[model samples]
Target: MLRGQAKGMATLFGQMLPAESSQGAEKAVQWAEVAGRLQSIWTEFQVEQLSKASGEKSHYTDPVKWIATFEAVMRQLPLSNPQVQQGLWDEVIAVLTAVLGQYGMGPRAFEEAKGDPHMPLRDRRFADPEWRSKPIFAVLHQLYLLLSTQVMKHAEAIEDLEPGRKAQLIFAAKTIVDALSPANFPLTNPVALAKANETGGESLIRGFEHMLDDLRKGQLTHTNPAAFKLGENIAVTPGKVVHETDLFQIIQYTPTTDKVLATPLVIFPPWINRFYILDLNAKKSFVRWAVEQGLTVFMVSWKSADASMADLLWDDYIQAQIDAIDHVRERLKVPAVHTIGYCVAGTTLAATLAVLARKGEADKVASATFFTAQVDFEGAGDLKVFVDDQQIETIGQLSPEGYVDGRYLAATFNILRGNDLIWNYVEKNYLKGEEYPAFDLLHWNGDVTNLPARWHRDYLRDLYRDNRLVVADSLSACGVPIDLHRITTPAYVQAGREDHIAPPSSVWKFTHYLSGPQTFLLAGSGHIAGVVNPPSSGKYQYWTNDESPDTLEEFVAGAKEHPGSWWPHWVEWIRALGSDEVSARGKRRPGGRGDKVIEDAPGRYVMTR
Candidate 1:
């Protein structure tokens, strides 16, 4: 059955290159040679591996269920209108006809035939010159484009479906298409085949070894993990832990400037990852930058939780932040401290702010800044696909121990950018047998952290699914009925324009809920790079407007585009909040350590895993 199906597919593919003309005949012969080599190498590896197996049969040739699964799911959704089905069928036939028309053409004619209106966007996966220069590869690329785009296009065309279902369908279809790309398979990947030939099949052997290693490790290798160390290289900023709790440790960074702002800054990074993401290196570190800018910086390093920590709830997380806030205030001898939170930490901080406001202690935080944080999940984008009730329950069941496994969370985020984070590594490490360059960002990304089961479930349900953070009294934190409107503290909201995890529209909704002086800045790039972007690199730009417009589109329309990182702009805004400069702390200790110092920066809590 498998061989017959494979032969049928090969025949259909062969017809897409004419056999009559001499030029077509030449290209067809080249394709056959390539196919023969690929088949030999694949069969050799499979047989060799199968011989050593435990006698359990493997289903390598099973037909792909991506599109079939999509069809099944869509049939159950509200996309069954006859017009929608007809529209999808008409598009599929039109694309198929256009694609098949290039069969009998010569090289130049085939190249020009790409001018058909249905040609997909320039996909970087097939960017190699050989994809166009070689006829078979070009045909494979074009046909793959037709199938993938049609799947996604039909998914988007079901306008009658609910917004949530539509978004889920589009994301699911895209993921399926991305996984089924010809570029992922050695037999279909032109680059992998050429590399195999060049190396006399050694690349395939090395790739097999690499695949085995990744299987043992239980994750794809995106970077050389050994290339970086926490204290020695990546998170090498100078600081000392001032306070510790079961939930978190507070690291007080020694200031770089002689004088520091009177109001110290406390940063609460997402517990899903280490705080070192903000202190990646001296150059890229936002914490280091803030310290150098004459500000006292304290970072909250969240402990990597296990099943023992599973019973912790959203209120517990909020209380932990509250504890950190109070500790920073008392240690610095200040009435209030400026605060910043990234991602989930920012969401919790917003709740803490509401809780503080309800308790009539709003002034404890001098100013608040959010990095790619969303309080409103109403168009939260692809991340929402993982948040429906059934999946949440499944996640709980998977985590019998009390905390959601960090690897599982890592996998969830990886699925969001499958083409980049998942398949790219699969191609490089497992197909090409090449190692990715050492990158601090990828290193930090791979260093995942567990979430307390109760906290994780409540977060997804309350903030993501129910979206109670923005609604008055709909959500509560620290036993206080939470109303984001009561957060009258001065606020600085920054969101990445291209962020997928936290969409700008949802982040912009932070402005709507906060009854405070507000500044909404839109940074370039996705979530991490945008937030960690520093001034010296002089990379992507940011947008700003004098007024926080009601709609994200309106804000974009009236905003001024400024070049380079938004770091300097943020510093200026926070400085204008009017805090005096004071002599830097820790004059007595060797490393400028404060009296309550526990350990060095990038604390032991971060090194847990």
Candidate 2:
């Protein structure tokens, strides 16, 4: 299956080449050179390994060790080139001169700390008493930064390299430097050393115990599970489960206002996570805020896929959403319903809308709001690096149970932001023997859900790898062709400025694909924080442009900055779409089509382990 997919990808790449003869030939030659160089590099790496194994002091024969050694050397190969070495030496000399000039300039020269919020490693080793007051360590840190900068510059200067290859090279260099940082070692990391001294080595003992507990549980220690209960402290919004299916449950949130909008709102959250992300707490819940705004809201609580659900496919999810939408329309007795989709759900919703458009029933949706969703995966960011042929093939072979394990997905995401999600936890929980914080967000992050093998495979292929969703007739769902251009519903799209998962530029491209009047919001935080932002927080700001530009760069340039949350902006947009004020329903009604109430809000599906 993976080999076929790979061949298709090659075909797509070939088709993407410029139609012009000269340009096409030049690109072909560049691709050929890259392929040849990669092969040669691998060959040299194998030869070096064999040579090392035959030495007087033989290298470790472990396959894992060999692979790690090869990867490390490959990352440094570019730096070893004569041209790159020259550039790096020049940068080193310049940094040294700067450091020397600062020597006699008083305490101010040495006062600047190595740690910057942008640089994670600066805080580790440099924070130790031995290094903190020493000017030499500071100079060494600056020189390291200079070397990294120069290496990146060199990588970027490689002419005609594919964007993917360039990105990989830059990331590889970064990973190597991060791994080799002095801060990771116990002797060099002052914080770790001080903790050991203060605790008389108790911290290490406790850390060892924590590691054992985590291993036994088959997961990382991310949050204090005892600190939260689903229906109490976390998913506490008042609601009732009006319906249930094999795939999901529909929760009808009780209105907080005296009157509600005539057009009800329905939400489809990404199944990769629990639904409570939007309803994390009373203070942070978007669901609660919407309810207070007099919008009668209903949310789909997706079942955590297990062995029984391993056969579920993408079509199954889309159909379930369609069924939920129909149920909402009937239950609320509204001809049309407003819809919101978050993350993967947003992608699925877009596809469903296209299916609706094909069936001449697009009017069923009053309006569509997409939160950090991507239809065009062209600039999908670093996550793309892990979705290539070899990786996908490996996953396919391993997931014989017909589901991708949630733990693997969690680990991959954690690695993407290792400084915050992985290493910070390592330094605190393992080194410092600190307990994991009882933060609600981290708790939700740890509560992962499996993706059915078929669904996961198809999604990565059709969307991320094939780029089929944006291309008309290239993909289909629910037995109908999918195309974003066909959907005419007015859209409210939000993207995070600092979101590595779905870059703002990629999210902004949604405006270009949708034919309707689209409003693009650029939030100031990342994927989760940006969307969960409430006005009361007064934390992150957002940007908006009435005149949606053709390009993301232009939109950003001309956009007006707004203080606080984008919730009010979304509320106004939904209001403008013409939801009438009406008396709020006091009690839960039976779900549409005689579907019986299964349980209360934060229902069984959501509570699935």
Instruction: Compare the candidates by TM-score and give the number of the best one.
Output: 1
lDDT of each: 0.79, 0.75
Best by lDDT: 1
Q: What is the TM-score of each candidate against the true structure?
A: 0.84, 0.82
- How many clashes in each structure? 0, 1
Off by over 4 Å in 2: 1-76, 82-130, 133-154, 586-596
Q: Tell me the TM-score of model 1.
A: 0.84
Mark the 10 consecutive residues where model 1 has the least summed lDDT: 53-62
Instruction: Tell me how candidate 1 scores on lDDT.
Output: 0.79
For residues 219-299, write the lDDT of model 1, one tens digit per residue. Answer: 667788899998999999888877898889988887778788888889999999989889888899898889888888888
Residue-wise C-alpha lDDT for candidate 2, range 386-450, written one tens digit per residue: 67776678677647678877777887788687667876676677656677778999999989888
Model 1 spans with C-alpha error above 4 angstroms: 1-71, 74-122, 587-596
